[model samples]
Target: MRILFRLVAAVATVLVGQTAVAEPLTLIIARAVAVPDSVSGQAMLSLKLTPDSGKAFARFTGANVGNIVDLSINGAVVTSPRIAEPIRGGEIMVSGTFKPGEVERIAERISAGDAKVEVDVKSE
Candidate 1:
């Protein structure tokens, strides 16, 4: 009975220690995507980019698309394309989060369709 109590106490101590440590979440690009449009005479493909920040992690979801190597998310390229595609789907949802302790809030704008859209990203 005494040995059993000791074992339980040791386990509880370990669990408490683990919880005391604050582990921040990290962001990673899971995949690349492509998007096509009728902007030009040809089926022009421009990635539907979503610039996100301020969270511990961010998400990027989409199908492999253009030769465009990376998605410049609020001035930072957090994702890269595996291959190029003309007509793609669900690529705009590619998710990415700011690196733990690396994300900040920034005031910026980006070209969306034809208008400059405002954006907020964690400053470096």
Candidate 2:
């Protein structure tokens, strides 16, 4: 599918310690699919970023190596994974605690181009 992913709102500010603090950086996704895990044979979400988005993600991950990022679909939080290292290849795999058939439905929604995939970077 030809998906156009971009960052709608790059950053939002919140009141913290009587000062404006930026947290929870949001990134829209381009392409996604539901697949089986190679080792465990469980359902997982595979996300592929566009070239531009790949660069952006690389920069984001590179800067925030030890931070946690939340993956969500249609405002529902899916998984919050710690950034171990910079993901320069643009491929992100999300394996969460999914109920039976949940991953399939999510994949269908994403394939139909109706679901909104988001990544929220949390500040420490």
Candidate 3:
């Protein structure tokens, strides 16, 4: 299964203009729900890590306190927010200026269990 978890955007390397530029780490996430943004009053996507994944997330966030966490959609970085506290509840709110129909697509993909573990071989 693809590893998906909330992350504090740690500085990393990216080759740009023949130079290694520091870039925000791509935060792979599991499931997110589409909703209205609370602050901006715009479109938003709320995320909640799965049970098993949440445990690991708590531990990671606990260790990496006071860092910026990034959110990505379709392999593109959308938001990078700082960790205010340890996310024990596994709930995250993602709000951004998205293109048309982007929020619906994310919700659909998650609801359809796109992030779940895939089985290549079936056993009868």
Candidate 4:
């Protein structure tokens, strides 16, 4: 099963002074892995996007600095992180209070493309 992810680019419009009519961009995940945190030794989920999605993400973040980007999974909002700067890299690390086993399971599911992920950039 392939997970479909949508990135709403509302902040892009605000940055460029354009109308908020841009369609959401779809981002594809290349892979996900559970790795141990270097400092805390806790499990962490790492997500790598496909090349095209990475470029799209970089552009979106570059245009939306200081904006909040909401991340959703399975139609439920999970995290809303502020874009401090452009993320040119294709990798993202998700760290939380998840147990080791839980993180592993989540990583496996994501890597197998069994979850739907969405990112929404809202204008402040």
Please name the candidate that would achieve the greatest lDDT relative to the true structure.
Answer: 4
Most accurate candidate by TM-score:
4
Candidate 2, 8-123: lDDT as tens digits: 22222222323322244444457778899989999998877777777777887776677787777888889888879988887788897899889888877877778877666755
Q: What is the C-alpha lDDT profile of model 3 across 32-122, one tens digit per residue? A: 6788766776778777767766666666556545666555555555666665776787666767778878877877776666643210111
RMSD of each: 15.1, 12.5, 14.6, 11.5
- Segments of candidate 1 deviating more than 4 angstroms: 1-68, 89-91, 96-124
Residue-by-residue lDDT tens digits, candidate 1, 40-122: 22222233333332121222111222223344544455545443433223224333443332222211112322222222222
Reference-based TM-score, model 2: 0.71
Q: Candidate 2: global Cα-lDDT?
A: 0.73
TM for candidate 3 is 0.59
Which has the higher lDDT value, candidate number 3 or candidate number 4? 4
- C-alpha RMSD (angstroms) for model 1: 15.1
Q: Among all windows of ten consecutive residues in candidate 2, which has the lowest summed lDDT? A: 8-17
TM-score of each: 0.24, 0.71, 0.59, 0.73
Report the Cα lDDT for residue 30, model 1. Answer: 28
Model 1: lDDT equals: 0.33
- After superposition, candidate 4 runs with Cα above 4 Å error: 1-25, 122-124
TM-score, ranked from best to worst: 4, 2, 3, 1
Error of 2 at 44 (Å): 0.8
Locate the minimum summed-lDDT window of 10 residues in model 4.
Answer: 1-10
The lDDT per prediction is 0.33, 0.73, 0.56, 0.73
